[model samples]
Target: MNRKIVEAANIAINNLLPTKSRSLYDIAYNRFKKWCAEKNVQLYSENVFLSYFSENAKNYKSSI
Candidate 1:
């Protein structure tokens, strides 16, 4: 990714949370980025998100 996009993504993620939750959000975002890297997913889209969450959903159980 280009520097501008990377910076924008960082800023966007950081802005999604208050200060205390930033670290946790960062961990999840980094993992998603790493998964994208492993899967050679250079572009972002709704399908990519659906695929990722579908594949990983087994690892997260519902709280209800």
Candidate 2:
């Protein structure tokens, strides 16, 4: 991935997560990337990241 994308992903992950859990953050980040890839969306911006959360938050809650 491009450095900017990686950096953006890191920032997004940090903002979304409550605590500093590296493993959990990694899992979420990877899953976010996979979802973006499958949807042909870029996962390198705040808007896209927020959109993913907005779209999937309910599902995430139900699954937990």
Candidate 3:
């Protein structure tokens, strides 16, 4: 059941983005997955996202 959910999420991630931005999204998503594995983060939650982004916030710039 978990495997199927992961597969579906991957498919949705791959298919839902616009063509020109899909590559960037895939790269970012794969990198996040790698980070999760390295940190042994098995579960996804709001805190997971907050931690990831907070730790890497300096790497991104505001569009505004």
State which candidate has the highest lDDT.
1
- Please, what are the lDDT tens digits per residue for candidate 2 over residues 18-44? 776777878987998888998899537
Which ranking of candidates, highest TM-score first?
Answer: 1, 3, 2
User: Each prediction's Cα lDDT score?
Assistant: 0.93, 0.83, 0.90
TM-score against truth, every candidate: 0.73, 0.52, 0.68
Off by over 4 Å in 2: 1-20, 62-64
- For model 1, residues 1-64, the per-residue Cα lDDT tens digits are 7999999999997687899988888899899999999999999999999999998898998889
Better of 1 and 3 by TM-score: 1
Compared with the true structure, the alpha-carbon lDDT of candidate 2 equals: 0.83
Q: Using TM-score as the measure, name the better of candidate 2 and candidate 3.
A: 3
Residue lDDT tens for model 3, 1-64 = 6999999999997788789997898899999999899989999999999999987888888889
How many Å off is the CA of 37 in candidate 2?
A: 0.3
Off by over 4 Å in 1: 1-16
